[model samples]
Target chain A: MSVQPGPATALSMSSATPAIEAVELSKRYGEVQALDGLSIAVAPGTVFGLLGPNGAGKSTAVKILTTLARPDSGSATVAGIDVLRRPDAVRRAIGVVTQRSGVDPVATGRENLQLIGRIHGMRGGEIKARTAELLDRFELTEHADRPARTYSGGMQRKLDVAMGLIHRPQVLFLDEPTTGLDPEARSQMWQEISRLTGAEGLSILLTTHYLEEADQLAAELAIVDRGRIVAAGTPEQLKAGLRGDAIVVELADEVATAKAATALRAVPGAREITADGHTARARVDAGASALPAVLAGLEQAGVLVASATVARPSLDDVYLRHAGRAFAAAHEQEVA
Target chain B: MTTMVSHSGYLTVRAVRALVRQPVFLIITLMQPIIWLLLFGQLFSKVVEIPGFESTGSYLDYLTPGVVVMTALFSSGWSGMGFILDMERGVMDRLLSSPVRRGAMISGPLAYQAVTTVIQSVVIFVVGWLAGARFPGGLVGIVVTIVAAILLASALASFSNALALLLRSQESVIGVAQLLVLPLVFLSSAVMDIRVAPEWIQTVSTYNPVDWAATASRIVLSADPDWYEVLWRLGGLLAVAVVVGWLATRAFRTYQRAA
Candidate 1:
């Protein structure tokens, strides 16, 4: 089921043209279909997250939107410029920080910024001032003169984002921005990204596999699975769409999983049950009231429950409800 | 049009600055040309004494132009490494996604090779002169020789860039470059006079761009410079450079499509 944006987003959606829009975009790479009739619309001045597992066509979508690759069919636009017909114009309007760090390692951070600034047609004086401002803003001023290769991974990632923002682009694309970062750096990047949308009024299209990242930063998000949007809405809406809390029971062994699944099914108000290895998960209307019945049912079935807990639905639960599988399992399957 | 030119210029500066930052890499690249000028100049010194062999004075004098052309050829053949580096580092995709003219990606490195060829040719000239080789054609001759070298290097660099864009692998680019360079150097009159070369090699050398460059440079550096021979070969090299540069620029589309 396609969930519509909440009233807040709906009001904005009706008032302003979308900052980024793609309709039924599909792309094929020989035998593999990277994108299949995927579509999305991002409101201006908001962070739109494409949340997915690895190999979910997020990068491919970014590539096409940023004009780095052509889609086999469908149409997209960034800042109202058609991506296919006027890619250069689209390029002029959007900033893209790809999954890979795009900073030139041989050049100093300052040099890298200046070069990109020049490519974006910024004048010498403008480039110098902007470069300084970005370097200072990203906390890279101390190391601005050093070759980017010399910087730490977090620092290099910051430079990449700084480079993307050199031209004051209307929209920014951050593809897996914090994928390789440590916990500290990831949070730091999150703060920086949050500030970007608020003060600058820049629309951001961020692709992330991190559920927390999407929940924390995205004003609106679309969960992509197998090259299609499985669920799309505000994080709260997607979670609320499930209509209850999630009950997770940890069993003693893999052998008990089947018994636990059958047991959990008998408990009233529990539905959408899935069991794998030593864990059995289900959705219930009210976790506090439903937990004792669930555990009692499992006990009657002679299923040994190591522990059980119930919590409000997270993006993980929303993903399970929509995608019909766990996010981690999908990621593992992709890696395998 | 102006944007294209300016982008190309900025990218060229980027390419050159990258090389300049790594002085060790720059010196190592020049080592080959310097070795050929010194060692090969001595090794082939007696070749001019052979029957039907021609020389302005010594073998080193004849070999100086050969060294300049060979340096240009060998160095330019590896220009693809830079493109491959950019591709691997994700810089190429970043630049492609920017409002960058695709032509600049090709021309920038080609221009860098041209600048490198000039520096390399001058270095070889000085080394040859220090090792007792005399160029009677003087400063004008050296300038013309450097121009020929630049043309040859541009053509090779463009071809290398095209191969890099198409192959997108270091081993493949290296394999193809090695496959092309040695034959091109030996098949041309880089170290020996064509008069002493086999009939088929002379025929092959007549069509080789390397031969055009080497022969043109040698003629200009001789006591009696052949303006006609120099101009036509330089013109031929220019045409080849333009055609190959265009192909290299088009290769960006192939890369983008595949990407």
Candidate 2:
């Protein structure tokens, strides 16, 4: 309940005050530790992504930071306002687009926008103008008068985000904003989100399970696992943190995967060989130079390889290196 | 305080607008009370002829106020469905995370319910008049009857909201509301006269808020309205409304913690 600034503020303020800061947040629900000592800082006018698979506490962190829920232990600040002590102030300073669509399905798109604007204490003319502008911006102007339920899923999501931005908050929280969106809609949303920090001069904290989403939109990213951040850096830095390039070989069948892993390990610069199903993956100092040797080794070992490829380190590799498991595997485990 | 009032006003409009968009629901809800007034009024017209079943006019006159009060009970009992829908659709979280006043969330819907009760009561009164029910207490009596219904609806709506916030499930809210409404309706003079009912039923109705509303409405619409009885019951309904509304607003904290 204390309102005093936490260490995250002190540390980040020394450089430039973060638009959002959370220090050692921990939350427990019965036997599940939803969030454990999670800390993050987003610089002003930049997109910071919390990247994690499902149940990695990404949404939990967003909830605590946005003042929808409180962390059992820890403090947070949004727009220099204490989240725990003065949640209303934080609420005024930030706009939150939760993972779920928050649009009132029975209300028209424009009505939803106006209602939210009024809740934020916007004036009549201001609410009207802002609502129109947002509807146009989100390509929802044509459907502004229709009940939100009539809108497509992507359109409803767009209206939800538009309602969040109606008040022009200093910081925006997009918690898995593109979740459940079609590929085209997701890319469009990414374009809009990318433009927000620059065009609107708003800092954003987005959480997503998609590695490509984090890589495409975040200025800085954190990999969350089991309620804690396992890695935090720029997306490029996270990928570069892996020792070398990744060389993956898809075996013809599960029976050849083990042999392929052993064969790939014999290559001079390759290391960390692991086999999964019908695929074998290894790291090499250089992918282009190591590719021929890898394929040759597989051929010499009589391991029938269906395909072989070498590529620069991706966010997937970074996640695997740190989380000690494949990202897709972790995601599926959480889903199941 | 001003912000809370304004926020409540805006949200009330939102709720009303949402309801208006679904005209089918509105018609369906109105149909229930009209059907009850017509069917029950005809079916029980002879009950008034029994000994000790005192009445100054036809049976329809006695049943009109009862029907109004019953409509309030039945409609307000379902008010929680709106809250449950908001919760499921994530609209509750959106409002909670905004700078909106927490109290406004409860007050807004309560206000909407009040508005609905007025409309429904007026419609029932008009339908009763068309069906041969006449009010001797006239305009003042009609206004008072509507006010009583509003008060009762507000109280029940607050209770419904509290249940919604606590249960956070549509099926359970519907189940609990259905379970409570029938006993409240039949146990009172809403349909049957308390004079002819069992002594235990009469005693139970005395403490029931539903009975207070129906009895008060019936009294005001009578040839001789009792000022003391009308005011006392209205005051009691007001107190219950305030208490239940406060509890509903406080239930937001529990929802927040769980969220």
Instruction: Estimate the TM-score of every prediction.
Output: 0.95, 0.94
What does DockQ give for each predicted structure? 0.80, 0.77
Maximum-lDDT candidate: 1
Taking the tens digit of each residue's C-alpha lDDT, what string does model 2 give over B1-259? 9999999999999888877888887898899999988998889899889998978888899999998998988889998898898877888889889999988887889889988988889999999999999998899999999998898888888888888888888876797579988999899988878989999999999988888888888889888899899999899988998898888878777878888
The CAPRI quality class of candidate 2 comes to medium
Steric overlap count per candidate:
0, 0
DockQ of 1: 0.80
lDDT of 1 by residue, A1-336 (tens): 998788888556533788999998999998999999889999988999999998888888999999988898999988888999999999899898988788999899999999989999999789999999999999999999999999999999999999999999999999999988999999999999999999988999999999999999999999998888989999989987988889999898789888899998899888999998777999988899998899899999998888898888899998887888888888878878
For candidate 1, list the clashing residue pairs, or say none: none
- Report the interface RMSD that candidate 2 achieves against the true structure, in angstroms: 0.8
lDDT of 1: 0.90
Cα lDDT tens digits, model 2, A126-227, are 889999999999999999999899998899889988988999999999989988999999999999998898887789999999999999999999999999
- For candidate 2, the per-residue lDDT at B79 reads 89
TM-score of predicted chain B versus true chain B for each candidate: 0.96, 0.97
lDDT of 1 by residue, B1-259 (tens): 9998999999999888888999887898789888988888777789999998888599999998998988888888888989899888889878988998887877788888988888888888888899999999899999998998898888888888888889988886687568888899899988899889889999999999999988988888888887999899999999998898888878867877898
Q: Model 2 chain A, poorest ten-residue lDDT window?
A: A7-16
